[model samples]
Target chain A: MNPQFIMDGLVAGAMIGLGAIGVTLTYSILRFANFAHGEFLSWGAYLALAVSGALGFLATGLTRPIAPFSFGWSLPLALVIAIFLTGLLALVLDAVLFARLRSRGSAVIILVMASFGASLALRSLLEFLFTSKPAYYTKALQIAVRLGGGLRATPDQLLSLGVTVVVVVVIHLLLTRTEIGRSMRAVSENPALAGIAGIDVRRVIRFVWFIGAGLACIAGTMTGLLVQIRPYLGHDLLLPLFSAAILGGIGSVPGAMIAGLIVGLSEAGAVQLVGAEWRSAVSFVILVLVLLLRPRGLFGRPA
Target chain B: MTGASPIPAAGAPALETRGLVAGYEPDLPIVRGVDLSVASGELLVLLGPNGAGKSTLVKAIAGVVPIHAGTVSIGGRDITALPAHRKIGAGLAFVPQTENIFATLSIQENLQIAAAVLPKARRAERIAAMYAQFPDLAVKPARLAGSLSGGQRQMLAIARALMVDPPVLILDEPSAGLSPKIVADVFSMLTEINRAGVTVVLVEQNVKAALAIASRAIILVEGRIGHEGAAQDLLDDPILARLYLGTGQAMEARRP
Candidate 1:
């Protein structure tokens, strides 16, 4: 296979790794797969697009793409805004919908169904607001930088990789070094005991929603930056992200990241070895193989 | 076994159940019109055979199970409407028979979480006090609660409950399945805790051990109080002992 293909695989893998981490964390902590997570990516992208467009209208000179990375200032500002907004949206969603259901002692399957409804509502809302037309943050494509072994990558790709690393590290520290993090882990392990221990299980659930949705926002924005921005951007990536989370073990953060990268690279490699048409099938194949052989995924502890 | 000294009239009972009728389901009341009180610094043990509703009574007081009728008041405030957390805040602590600790958390973390309502500045001091009281816990505070032996886990559970400094601590069969040695150690710990002015209510299958430490004792048969009196009185009464203690066979064998 071509080295360009390998580099392409790594770039794509990084995004998958980031998105999968969010999926895995949410699953482990919340005990359910959040189907609406994909909408967060679209929300983030639209936020950046809207902000950048407003900035461009304010200053004609700002129409030019930023140096090093070809996106506009509006994109970065929008990403920050999008992360907070999306995170808040997730909190509200939990409070208004999931929290009530959870309080009623709703079953996991019912919660999963609720998430599905949330996904549909969010997807349609994005479509109604943004239209179906594909948009871009920046028209200017950066000059590809050649590394070694005939591999070349755009500056945006490298920036996305750096962002992924930073976010993962920060999250790792938050999970391991902080008091709230310990409480979160405790709640995840046994909510009743945690409650009796005075850990405030509700507060932990709120925090999980914020972090998971915020990470989903970042993942959505990064993916948008690397490719085209569309309302269904997150939806398209959902399968691979879920696959990565499952493969990495549902609650293991590092496992999700590693699994994501693996999925990304595998898809890229599959495209290279077979054809682009087979790329979408890669995650499914891995899912089936892992489910059959390991059943618990790579990091899943035995039940 | 009839006349155990009633709670002194000066201060409030550590725990009081006023006509408590409780159960897991609404249609069935497992504890029917049970009224009891444990005074400050008392080790009151509830002894009964299986299906005697001992667990249900304790759970109702702890706000774990619903009380169909009656009130559970801690100190002076009525806590029948309060949730479990509020009940804990009101100075009541509960140690369940099983899965009482956050298994994945370290022993220190478990205790820290239990002290979550305390001020941040006082947490370290409170933890130190607990560790001093339970020195065996101090040795492996960093170990996961799940990895600890059964005896150590029970100690951690009790320690976790004590972190809130509750005046009344309830344990559901603290020695249900432990060996004789561990059971003795647990009973000794209960006595020490009671001696330190923490009111303790224990539910136990080991009739003799429970009676040995208890200041007051109550025996429940099919959810109603069958026998109530002093611990020593229950121990000495042959008919009461035979009926409730399952020592009928041994009592007959030793007949003069």
Candidate 2:
């Protein structure tokens, strides 16, 4: 069997893990399954794409590729802007839809349904504006670096994995060492207790959206770099993102990362063992098994 | 605990409520118009039969329940409209009956989160103070609060509320699931806290034990104050036992 599948899975798992942090966080704190979260990934990719294109339009040299990587400084610069915009988009959705519904004390099912509607609207908007045609970060191709053992990967893929580790470590420290991080955990555990303990529950909710969306932006940018960017890029990843999050356990950062890798490796193995057509079913199978065996996921505390 | 006064000053009631009406819904209020006053450094127990609104009254004052009309104040400052979270900053701390601790979080984390309202530089010192008060929690700061024994959990909940050093402390049924000995330990702790200048208000089902440590008691019957007096007086009042305490037959049977 080709060991190349391992690299491919790790790279894909890194992206899925990064994206699932947002899902686990939102679910843990807001207590809802936000179907629209996948849309944030699509939005992040497109927003960065548009910003990168704009930079190139202004100055051609700005788009020049960095020596080892596929994209230029402009793509990284665009990534920052895209992150901010995606976070803003999350807040906008919360303000217009989720926040109002929450204030009125809406049911969890209603919030989930609302997120589905939001997801549809977001995906449709991307399709209408950018069309369903797949886009590329750079058409230029580079030689894969050989790391022996018949294993190889592009610089872009390596960079994605590195960035994910840094992000996960940073998030781990934030949740464990920082005050805001503890507040998020406290709110996720018991919101009423949090409020009485003097935590501003509303502020924590807003912060969750902002940071969760920012994390999703990084994942989207990574996906766009590794694969083709399409309106349904995030749509296709919804199941896998959820699988990683639940498998890792809700509200657990490290769990999401490990679960993401497991899902990714399993899918890649499925592609090798079976056919590529059955790749998507891997996440479904894992999710079903988890629901049957361990509904709390890997790290979630039993309810 | 900084800009706002964290303790009531001289001549001002530690906590006061005028015409409080509160519940989950705006139209359906569980706590009817209940005007109550708790003086500084007082240990007061709220007792009642089932559905008497004892919990609701304190919850309303603590800002957990929706107050339709009322004025709650600490240190002569009006805080009725203030959100539940801000009340801690205004010298009021509340501990709910159930789910008071973040079970998934470590004991240190639970205490640290409660102390977030304090200045960053002061947080460690304050947490140290709490550790000194409850050596059991200090023994295992890294332990998950959910794994704590019932008595230890109650202590941790009180410690969390006391983290902010608020002047007025309120709790709802803290002894609900605890044994009688643990209940006594908790009540004695409350008495000590009250003696140290914090006003204490408790909603207790362990009426006899609560009276032992309480300086005063207020019995509620259907969202209104049915009776109130000195704690010692209420304990011996046979009429109070027969009418509202629900232990009339037991008291009569035990009598010589």
Candidate 3:
């Protein structure tokens, strides 16, 4: 029972939780599991890379680290742009591809297949542009700060947790207090009824894509900050992302986050018991067990 | 309400469908050549047996079913080609027969979603007003709509449509599957809503109960208008009841 394993799990869980929110949301509203969602994370990391490279000189002072931090203001600025670009990419993909299939009343399997095809195309393009090698945001490394319980974490890991909290709070406010948020929930429950209620179903869908993609972007940025950014940054997290979403109960935001923590802790614990090579298999095992035990997930309604 | 004059001879009809031809499939028309009009403040009850296309006709008017040929106008504004989501903007609200409310959302959230089309400033006021109108819903605002009893769900469905405060309200089988007492209460609620100045178009199978509160009634048989006249007049003619609903004996036995 190494305390460091639990701390590492918390850091990794924040990233997966952020990514799972979009997966759960898309599955709930669109009624299909989008395999291409992971590509948005990859795209976010690369977009930030490109933006920071192009605009690094303009914010040379901001790019320099202030203190205990490794990366600086430039990465944050790039993150904002990356979030917008990734969200726009998602909207374009939906408008050009998914929307057509949906309007024609394509089956859910078809949408899922289209997503697989999309995932391949996106991953290929990303690798072609950025190469297969890993990229880092900053060359400097920060020392891990020790906590009282024999646990240690880098400053970036702690900062990632803080950002996750802020984002989750913002999403909470949006979902509970805003009109569009209520409309989104209504559409997920019954799209036809939502339409009859005077809600613009298409508009609500577009907004969902924006929020879902934007959050995925932030998750990708955090993952890249924690580990090195690579073309398969999203690919590597895909299993964990989906497992978190299903385990949390599809369509439940807070559920996904909690499931994310559980999945992360399990994977971290599995690595200590088995080996690092078996970490990826942990998500599959947990997902299978949960499905067999409770197909609707912890908080999901009965099917 | 029995002898309310047809069309009022006043402002434009609250809702009008001319030469309406529609169906789920392109070639097979479920409803065709249906021309109907309802005036302001009128309770027009539509009645028919199974496969009579009663629900289809109502859905076509509400813009749920696709219209192949014809025009649907509300307040003289042509809205024939408008999608279901846009019909509410044309001063109309529709309540479908099944899955009529957001089952998982809280009762209050159901009303809030309906009020999304209005300006943000008035949403709270409108929601508060709906609570006042449907006191049963007001008591348990936090309950999931799906958990509600059949009668309560029906009330919530109607209240959801009324959230938009449309001039024309169309409901398909609002009394379907409800207990007899609840059905009576729902019909009275419809009449009450109609008297409050919202024109109502009800598609119902409960002919006797529906006709009681209806100002006008139209009977559909096999996708065409079989009978059209005042509600009391239709109820009085025993032969028409037999031809239209096949319940002539029961309807005649109840006649005073």
* TM-score of model number 1: 0.91
lDDT of 3 by residue, B4-75 (tens): 112223488888989888888869888878888888888999987677788888888877777888898887
Ranking by lDDT: 2, 3, 1
In terms of docking quality, how is candidate 3 classified?
medium
DockQ, model 2, C-alpha based = 0.83
Could you tell me every candidate's TM-score relative to the true structure? 0.91, 0.97, 0.95
lDDT of 2 by residue, A1-303 (tens): 898999889899999999999999999999999999999999999999999999988988988999899888889999999999999999999999999999999999999999999999999999999999999988879788998889999998988999999999999999989989999999998888899999999999999999999999899989988998999989899999999999999999999999999999999999999989999999999999999999999998887
Tell how far residue B10 is off in model 3, in angstroms: 5.6
As a whole number from 0 to 100, the lDDT of residue A133 in candidate 1 is 89
Clashing pairs in 2: none
- lDDT (Cα, tens digit) per residue for candidate 1, span A1-303: 577987777777778878888787778888988888877777877876787688788876766667888976767777787788888888999999999999887899999999999999989998999998888888887789988789899999999988988988888788877788888888788776666666667888898888888888888888888888999999988888988988998777787888988999899899888999999999999888888888678988666
**Model number with the top DockQ:** 2
DockQ of 1: 0.51
lDDT at A274, model 1: 92
Q: Is candidate 1 or candidate 3 better by TM-score?
A: 3
Could you give the CAPRI-style class of model 2?
A: high
- TM-score ranking from best to worst? 2, 3, 1
Q: Which candidate is the best by TM-score?
A: 2
| Interface RMSD of candidate number 2 | 0.7
